[model samples]
Target: MYRDHSVGVVMPAYNEEGFVGDVICDLPEFVDRVYVIDDCSTDGTWDEIREAASRDAAADDEPVAETALLADGGDSALSERATIGDPVGRVIPIRHRENRGAGGAIKTGYLAAVGDDMDVTVTVDADGQMDLEQMPRLIDPIVDGEAEYAKGNRLLYREFRQDMPRFRFLGNSILTFLTKIASGYWKTMDPQNGYTAISGYALANVGVESMYEYYGYCNDLLVKLNAKGMRVADVAIPAIYGDEASSISYPTYIRRVSWMLFKNFCWRLKVKYLVLDFHPLALFYVFGTATAALGVLGGLWSLYVKYANGDPLFVRASLSLLLFLIGSLFLMFAMLFDMQVNEQKEVQIRE
Candidate 1:
């Protein structure tokens, strides 16, 4: 165990036949278990997971080398010792009958980890894009009680940012801004990065079963964690891009996730400010949103009226400008209040 806490990695595979085995074999030795969930891949992903599990179970004394041959290939020459020890941990293969999203697979793994009494559970992608060696760094905050959840932040360094595509980087920045406002974790970035670790307490308390079961799950989880006052740490980790195919449509994914965040923002305000304890930030947000909407709409209507007829636009313009300025001030104050309230919840893990 790492830092005296039982570590488990959850891998969600979807048509990742080529990389699943490598990911499984590359897990750190300190990890106690690896849960591989196959999301009804149309390829041989499940077969590869089974083969990896067998190799892991068979290699009792030494690490086993990974082979590309099928499990039933019956090639004796392909069996070789791996570079690590005994494949580190036992591989538990879980297959879903229908194609649930990556989030669903992760929830399944979380449940299994909780049931097995694991202290820390880390979620790693099936496609070899995540560095398994960084597992310890990801779990450190949770193990140390500094944070209930920790997530990889690929934008922490310039070199790491250069590794991402230009378009993706821009998209990530926009989403990060939205997520900051929605999740109330202004210090965190890379909202889409899925490499994360969570304590058992968080996994059980965050209501995993009711979480969003799709690509937006990461952002959604942040909002829920914030509502529960769960501390979150942003672990600096590099992005690793490979030949793995992406299943997301950028435009569609962004739109859906944006809507989800808007809804989550409202829910958080209601649950945290209205139901749990009354806070002035809630009023600030309400007034700010309403004022901004009226200002924009009123401005547009005034412009239309001026063009349609020779009506005086001075009063309308002044009113819109006044409303806009007041709304912006309220929003700024609300943001300050939010940051102050959540300052203690931002976990800082020193390297």
Candidate 2:
């Protein structure tokens, strides 16, 4: 156990066949359990997990649970859940009946951690990009009662993100800005970073079943945490880039996630402000967005009418400008209020 807390690492693997074994072996001894989820990789990633689990001379006789989860609607080659354990720690390997993406794999690991009564759970990808030595740092805030959820932030500075690919860095920046508004965690960045630790309380309460099952799950989880008033911390950490190719299709992934965030934004406002308690920020956001949209539409209409006919444009253009400014002011105020309301909910854990 790390600092008297039962810490578990959730490593989600896809087609990471060759490198998966090393990532599993690199986990610190303090971790009480490691959940390696194989999302039905087309490669031999499952075999690598089994090989790594046997490194400690694991005992496969003692099964945690003998039951199998119902497979997804189609024919899946995967089997029931199985775990390997000796004396030091347990290595639980779960294979999805079908490919459920990275987020779905992590959610399976999260539920496994929750099921085993783990105190703290941390997520690490199986590609060996994350530095396992910093695992303690990620678990510190959650163990100390400072934050329920703590994540590594790789985009805090230029040097921190230097090793990241230029395209990935650029896309991450755009998503970070949009996620700030959507998740209402203005102080945090790098919503897509997967290196994170979450407490059992937050895990059980965050409603993991409803979380997104794709690349944008991190962003979706942030929205859920904000609505539930869970404290979050952003810890500065470095990322290692290697020869592994990204599995995500950036163009399609970003488009779908962006739409998901828009829907989540609306849901969060209602849950946080209307359902639980009454807050004017919800109204401010609604009116501000509506007026800003109307202003842009009105401005375009006025320009079209002026060009099509000889109608005067001054009054109409001026009205559009006025509406846009008012909407902008309202949006600014709403964001400020949001930041204030969540001020204590965020902690910047700089190294």
Evaluated at residue 299, the lDDT of candidate 2 is: 99
Kindly list the per-residue Cα lDDT of model 1 for residues 1-351, writing each as its tens digit: 788887778888999989999888777877777878888899999889888877766664544333222234322321221011123237767777677788878776776666556789899998988888788888888877899999998787788787778887888888999999999999988979999999988887888767887898999999999999999999888767789889988888888899999999999999998998999999999999899888988899999999999799999988998898899889999999999999999975544
- Error at 328, model 1, angstroms: 1.5
Q: Please provide TM-scores, in order, for all candidate models, with all chains considered together.
A: 0.90, 0.91
lDDT for position 310 in model 1: 72
- List clash counts for every candidate, in order: 4, 0
Candidate 2, residues 1-351, lDDT tens digits: the string is 789888888889999998888988877877777888888889999888888888743533333332122223211222332232222226767777777898888877887776666889999998888989998888999989999999999877578678777887788888898899999999999999999999999998999878898999899999999999999999988887787778888888888889999999999999999999989999999999889888888899999999999799999999998898888889999999999999999999887
Predicted structure 1: lDDT? 0.82
In order, the Cα lDDT scores of the candidates are 0.82, 0.83
lDDT of 1 at 290: 91
Best by TM-score: 2
